[model samples]
Target chain A: DAGVTQSPTHLIKTRGQQVTLRCSPKSGHDTVSWYQQALGQGPQFIFQYYEEEERQRGNFPDRFSGHQFPNYSSELNVNALLLGDSALYLCASSSPFESGYTFGSGTRLTVV
Target chain B: GESVGLHLPTLSVQEGDNSIINCAYSNSASDYFIWYKQESGKGPQFIIDIRSNMDKRQGQRVTVLLNKTVKHLSLQIAATQPGDSAVYFCAENPSYAGGTSYGKLTFGQGTILTVHP
Candidate 1:
């Protein structure tokens, strides 16, 4: 079975521009969660989606939004990107039986 | 803000030496714990996990120990190797928070591990 896969392995965007990242969950998984990892820092929870609906969100502002498709694919969108938005965006997929999450390679976003 | 923090920023050890990384979490309600390893420029990968009910869980060369009494969590690597060099993070999940609570992971500041030959 394939693990979580993310698209646009690397992205370069300027400040105030918007970007969308995509992720495909592993086989048989139904939950998708997003995280932001800054340099030398651990990942911070952005939000989680289940059943194609956002079930929870982190401390991030309204600028960060996400969508989960019925097939368990997910997309993370950032509006008016800031320099601070530059980081490794990780997509983790998991199921209730398996609390341990499997993370994708991640999309590296660099906001200049 | 509630957070999971590490006592050390970096640690170095020779190959074949055992390594231990520590983490402290402020949220006592957190019932689930996990440890992840992230190489430079890579997403965090699951290493091992221990539930609140268990005090210790061992996997392959990695072992995770959770101390609910002190709200402390630790990852122990036996016979550490060069491949073990990476940033280690501890995460906690507070079940009481409710809603999409299963996958949510609050990570620690992270400890960078460097293994020398």
Candidate 2:
């Protein structure tokens, strides 16, 4: 089965511009979560989406938001992006009842 | 706030030698833990996981050990290969927390493993 897939493998945007990264969870998975990984750092949880609603969020600012579609696909939107927002955006999928999660290849966003 | 951290930022092991990466978590109530391997330009791949009740869990060429008392976790890789050279991360899920019924994961700083041939 295909694993979690994310679009726009790499992106470049300027400060104050909004950007949206997309993710399609692995087949048969319903829950989708977003993470941010800076260079030489581990991925940090941004938020999780289940049942089309944001179920949980990390300590990120209001500039970070996400949505889960009925098809189990997800989108992470970062508004008023800062240079610090330049990082690898990873998408993870899991079942609510299971502890294991599958992650996508991630989208590398570069803010100029 | 609680967090997970790694003791070593980088590890160098000879090819075919076994490798061990360690992590410590501050959340005592975390019930689930996972180990993920991430290669360059890729997302973290699930390597293994262990629950609070289980002291150890084994997978193909890998093992995860959990110490609830010290709140420590470890990942052991046998017969390490060049492909195993990557950053390893440990994540914990605090199921007992008041929010997030799905149990969100908090990841460590990651350990970079370099397999030297």
Candidate 1 lDDT over residue span A41-99, tens digit each: 88899999999999889999999999999898999999999999999999999886555
How many Å off is the CA of B61 in candidate 1? 1.5
Query: Could you tell me which 10 consecutive residues in candidate 2 chain A have the lowest summed lDDT?
Result: A93-102
Cα lDDT tens digits for candidate 2, A1-112 = 8999999999999999999999999888898989999998788889999899998889899999989899999999999999999999999998745558899999999999
lDDT (tens digit, per residue) of candidate 2 on B37-79: 9998888999998878899999999999999999899999999
TM-score of 1: 0.95
Give lDDT tens digits, candidate 1, residues B1-117.
Answer: 679999999999999999999999998888888899998867788999887889999999999999999999999999999999999999998862222337478999899999999
List of clashing residue pairs for candidate 2: none
Error of 1 at B59 (Å): 1.1
- Whole-model lDDT, model 2: 0.91
Cα lDDT for residue B23, candidate 1: 96
lDDT for residue A91 in candidate 2, whole number 0-100: 93
